[model samples]
Target chain A: MEKEKVKLRIYGMTCDDCVSTVTAGLKKQKGVIDVKVSLKDGTGEVNINNKEVKPEELLRNEVFTRPSHYKAIIIND
Target chain B: MSEPEKFDLVIIGRGAAAFSAAIKASELSNGEMTIAMVGTGPIGGTCVNVGCVPSKYLLEASHSVFKPAHPRMPGLHETEVKYDFSKIMEGLRSYVSHARDSKYVKVIENYSNVKLFTGLGSFLDKKTVVITGPDGKEVGKVSGSNILIATGSHPSIPNIKGLSNTGFITSDTIWEMNELPESVAIIGGGAIGLEIGQALLHFGSKVIVIEAMDSILPQTEGEIREALKKELESEGMRFYLRARVSAVSRSGNWKSLDVITHKGNEKITVKEIIVATGRQPNTEYLNLERVDVKTDPRGLIITSDTMKTSASGIYAAGDCVSKNMFLETLAAREGVVAVSNIFGENIKIDYNSTTWAVFTNPQVAGVGMTEREFSKMNGSCSTRTFSLLNLTKASITGETEGLIKIVVDPKDNRIVGMQILAPNATDIITEGAYAVRNGYTIDDVISTSHIFPSFSEGVKLAAQSFIRDISKMACCVE
Candidate 1:
């Protein structure tokens, strides 16, 4: 399986805890290897080792104030 | 080589959620947990900075000005009504600063396990976050085994043509303007738009709200929305429901907005335009693809009931994930849940327990299932409502325009939803949300103690009505 690092442009983050919240959430995933969160521009970077991750799986799992505000996209592979 | 400093946790937001999480993490550790915080805004996040705190102050100030001026009051004072936008904004700004400094920063800095980084934090990896100072200088990186993303959301600017060129401002941007526009068009009738719109209306703006939906407060009950619409319209604000704005143009200092109205094409000229079309998750930059996190079409980061995203060791909270009623209270709640779960506590978020309110004249609020939602879920549920005009407090406050609507599940008498349209509706709905969230029966509400002649009695009345037999409802007192 190809190794992929994904970047998530996060919105609705207010402080360092926001970055930590997302980082801690992603770190719980089974295939996730690394998680980086940026509070400056409201973005998160994550590393995965398998093809098991799907966007729907993530969307179905998170609790947000309004789920529509945040998005995760693959910037590289 | 010096050994790297190993921290137990790193949080990236400074709001109630971040600080609270830090406090909790500190307590959980054996006096050895190292927590790092990176935030760009003032110490407090949205709730204290640009969101609830400041907005509510402005709302209260304006409400005080308007409440005494209503026609229904017994005796009218010959006092002139006016709002100095700058002064009100100044006070709010000062309050926000104090809240951030005294409440947020002081707490974080005082925590022995926490390291505060007053800058923008970017992810070097899942375990490392690089902090950049306001001057664009690299401060340092804090690498933690567990990273929490509490970065809150911001206002979502739509993709309307020429919107940016027209110099339209969002809720976050409007706070800085020294002068309020005499005439302004607020697009999107959601909480932010409506709250700011009502504030501006009281502040002397001829506010016009253009909503894409058929009614304002879309998620609320129809009756409450209707009541709010009537009250706001009576207060001199205009509503253009089912209106779609196609283009915006600016000529010199004035602006022209082209809207596709239900009747036909219309052009509105206003001094300013506020696009409150709702907020998008601040995900465009966070390089989620690097971590393989998935988002919905609207850019909401996908997370689970546990606030965990797709990738391992990552978590998302606040408005960044897919959820509705993007409120500060909800965000704070989710923030606590996300962090606690990360520290090995197994807890799931309870969406049904969340309460939402739109700060408007005769404020609108809803909790649990709205009548619409309940009816959609089970076709047999019934509704009962109590008008504020029937309540003595409304007469005293002279705000008798809205009502309380309760949706009850007929089979088990569960209070599924409650909606309110009245002054202090946001504050009043908290009790109702607690009831509904706990699946309290309407009988419980009716049996509870309520102050005599209070607007909250309306809730008790509606609950009583729902608990009564159908024969009594059909032959009730006139």
Candidate 2:
């Protein structure tokens, strides 16, 4: 039942606006408890309720595909 | 022709019920079965399309305007709020569109087997349905082994003379109103009437509510109804009780209503008339008789607790089958039940546990049986009423105009029902509903802790009333 964390390298970022867009997207995901999107690193750190969601599902979220340019890939290591 | 289009299930609605059934059917069949969903009007049913979304949005939006001008706190300066009413209406429409696309339209996109058909679906026979376009031409035909009659309800216009010809707005058509009327006469005095009437009154409209019953919210707990009447009256909203609209006639620039109030017959004039008498199930064009589906005298489709119609392979749910309450959540639940029964399971809907709310300021909410219903059903029950004046939250917030009433069966000490009339009562009633649904005792309710200084704390205090005089109890006492 522990909270799970996922780090993603988000694309199509040019300004703080992209971070906000990604943050809103991550927050809307199921089981998402907390979301922190860094404009500098272009990374989205998400805390999720593990029972209802898995880390891999974040890569498949519509937020990445809707604009057809914004993308996210799970960061390894 | 070789053959007509065939589906595993043909759902007769695009709203909550049909959407819910489509999801359940997908789950049951593992995305293997075909589903044909036919609908009329908007895609998201009454709630998002016309009823809850736009109505509640305006209520809260206008609150920003109305509350500042009519300041509750004594020290606060009365500041006038101004805005273009048409722009606000436009904003409401946009919000409704976003909500519908997200909540209703996109929810079903995951199920590829479920197909959407835009038309009015009518039963050709028990197994077949024909879709008709707005032009009154036959659009298409589809037959399913199983059909779900999830067609919900529409606003009911009363039989008053010239009501239709003279023109009036119901919940369904009120969204089209761009300009705020100078004054309005709202009929029914029910949840729909009071909620919208209060919102318009907040927006500086001269609002008069006419109720055929002796009191507003006649179906709610008596004390809750009385408290609501008092609260609304204090806000300068007018009421005409034990009244009926005899006729409606439109004159130059205004309309006149011949109303038979308890005192005497009075002719009232208003710029707009809103009929909120109630809603009737959307079954008129369904041709249910062809399928041997039975309906109550009120024209609601009759279905078993399991959501099965009298006819085999046909099931009904939502406002079409609901006896008293018409809610989106209830409709979705009934849809699930119908789909489950169709797929061979016996899941019954427990009406006793159904929780609903009226979204007037100082909202009204209830779950389970009232003292009147409990006493009549079981012959005896104990009760307690906890006033908002005593609740620390209500006192601190300066919104002490409501009460919570809990009904307990004397024999078992189990809480049979709970009714609340207070700020955020709608959200708080869920706890009461959970208790009544599972036969939780008064002690159980008291054992669980509620957040202090919160409106929901009233539920705990009401439960505590059975054991001791909660009026003298210290705040935050265990």
Candidate 3:
């Protein structure tokens, strides 16, 4: 299976705790191979198996939905 | 009897400022610095003990109890929730104790170089302090190369006729009561009074808030203040603006307050009275004058940007020192800054981006200048506000009662200030703080993708409203 790296501009992270929360939430998503969230730049990068999961599907997951109060926008690079 | 103990740093008071200083000093010195902390009061200071922690806990409990009857959704039936006031108080005490233990006491135990002394510390000289126990006896003496006075503030009771004689409870003492008052007259409509007033009202108490000024929340924006007042008033909380309590006297089992308002003199009777006027610095016991340390007229210790008192090697932070605002985060930052400067780094405290919140039902928070402040300086600045009524998320949650106001400097389109009055304003204000701190413009905020059906989208909506009519735009339109 092929794997792809997706970079997202995460919003509403105020501290390291928020970064950890986003990292943990992303890692729980389907087909996610690895995740790294940065507080300094307010961005997150995740590697996922492209054959099994789509990047847009992961972007619309409940992890970035209401009640969690965080958002992520994929950056096309 | 023996020689006075000496160390590298001596911190007086055990609140946020003192703990922050000790922790930062320990980190900077790689846990090798010897420090002595003398505190006669509670260990965790105001934030963890009586001020923020307990108050917020009670507020949340009140919110839970009030939610059933005041559910905003249609077809949701009101349900009764019975509560034991004493049990709630017990829970609050336990929570405060747990927080203090985990956040302060246990954390301090790991710093082997730090010593804790439960006593009042007064300056013997520039580098020495005589510790006195609660019994007023001299316990011991400790000397240090540098000293920090983070002794926090206490609630200031007004000098009303017969006030002291009639007796009253303050925010500090009110927590000790097990039974809720049948009716409470909260004096001075500041943040504490308003918050406590609303909480008590929700907990089934008849609450009346009296403010000597024409408006409540004197420091907040006028629109925000009016909006909050209207909301609370609709919920049956009473308010007497521009009122002065001329006298307080007891009548049977009730307390009577003779208030002089704009209309005329009126008498208010309540089962209890809470004085939330303001706070004064805890510098009285520090013997600051004896040590020639300067203090403002209000008894707040005067300090330089580096947190240094008039006496060299003596520094102050937190509510004890003069600053634009008193907050736990700001106090901690000041402590860290002071320690960095002491360790040969040049740093100054900056409050331009300091954010604060009043924990009311619809929390009021602001970062940077208010509309009035901006108008006073520059008349050319543009302002935009979006009501929660138009925000999709607020409507979905049935909490469309607040508004977000953004003030921008049109010259460079940079956001100068932002004020939010919403259910989660406290959590959302930090985004505005970041924008104002980094000089982000309205376009920067609007371009960022906010989660749909989220309170934070209010920021983007307000920013978007500046360029085009938001009502004409689609839900996810840029």
Candidate 4:
């Protein structure tokens, strides 16, 4: 039940499985209600319920750039 | 005349498992293998004879009446369905006969090397099975290079005072009823119990379901079970969860049961009673100890992943065993696996990806790990639930009582588990089985492009809920 939508450009996703990994990781975060990651576009659209949680927090989330080879950066637009 | 019949394989049941094993063995031997199929019951086993075939036919027939009397569509008016119980059961019996002939009897006829023997097959030795007739005489003997014990199972009636002597029927013998009872109370809220209960309700019988557990279908997910309970309750099916039948009494044509629950005890009388507590394997008469074949504490034959029993040269599958369970298809698969492993295929069945269903109006089906299971395996896991309220298919059909849920492994977001409660959840769960079995992620389910405006879309939408807020999204948005 989140309403705030955010977009983030992703890096290092090689297969469709990576899309799911990123989606799950982002959705696992406490305020996130919805997440859609596209390996085709290297971008993800996300919905967050908490105003305290920012897009910048998702960028450095451990789900990306560790055991998994994915990275994210805030898309201001 | 003094020589015992020597066969390449001996199967101790003629049900799905035995027939499948025979076919596989024959195929492996290039139709040259001689097989002895020994059975105590009908040739097709419990399924076509007393289980799935008749049960499903009854479900469909009852649903036909149920749909019209309780019309969901606004444009459709409620219609009365006056059905003759005997005639409806006669048709079901006819269908069962046809299925037995087509699926089992004829299939066996194609295997010229297979000989069907009707008797109680018990172990004469590890390699030989002795067939005894019901008249307490030695009917035949089968000595084989290898043996399969697919003897299936029998209904396990709970030990309540006066219950046995009070007289009742099981799912098996219920097919023999000449008339549907005016009222019936079924003990045990398992799948078969509810199935028969609901079908009888639609046929105008006052149905009562009593379960020792707090909920029916104890193995099913909580949401799915509760949803079904609600639907069935709405349809006038009464439930007595957290209850046990303490005593029984027979008065003329009616039977009365003393039902004990935490609250209090109540005596209810009905025309008939169905004991559907559960099932136990048919290893009791197998004389497994004579052959050193070990059964578990509960009498289920123990087998390895390869479907090989503790005793070498012997295998077991189907309801008689603990692993494969009561589904006719799974039993057949286990039989094939046992036969294939005997032929050195080294095949093992993955039960995690296996699927099963109930035939109630809004059917329930599931595959792989449940949400709790996934959480237990992984310290924590993500789970998503989708309501059929948003489904176009449900909206169009005007039958919108359903829920679809997916359990995900957070690390990879793979669809580790799926369960559904819907009109066609049984059919839709196949895609979930394939996805879980093949390690397909939720995106894989979404990318598969399910047919638009179909019940199957519930699965895709469930997957989409992992990403999109479906309530606000446009129809079929990526």
Interface Cα RMSD per model, in Å? Answer: 13.4, 17.5, 20.4, 28.1
- How do the residues B158-216 of candidate 1 rate in per-residue lDDT, one tens digit apiece? 77899988898877877687787889999998788889889888777899999999988
What is the Å distance of residue B372 in model 2 from its true position?
Answer: 0.2
The reply for model 2, stretches above 4 Å from the true place, is: A1-77
Error of 2 at B348 (Å): 0.5
What tens digits encode model 4's per-residue C-alpha lDDT throughout A1-77?
43688777566677988888888888888778789888887778988875657555676566754455565544433
Task: Give one digit per residue, the lDDT tens place, for model 4 in B420-451.
Answer: 99999999999999989999999998888888
Candidate 1 regions exceeding 4 Å error are: A1-77, B1-5, B132-139, B467-478
DockQ of each: 0.03, 0.01, 0.01, 0.01
TM-score of chain B of 1: 0.92
Q: Which stretches of candidate 3 lie over 4 Å from their true place?
A: A1-77
Docking class of 1: incorrect
The whole-model lDDT of each prediction reads 0.75, 0.86, 0.87, 0.86
Q: What is candidate 2's DockQ?
A: 0.01
Residue B88's C-alpha lDDT in candidate 4? 89
Order of models, best lDDT first: 3, 2, 4, 1
lDDT minimum window of 10 residues, candidate 3 chain B: B338-347
Q: Quick one: ranking by DockQ, best first?
A: 1, 2, 3, 4
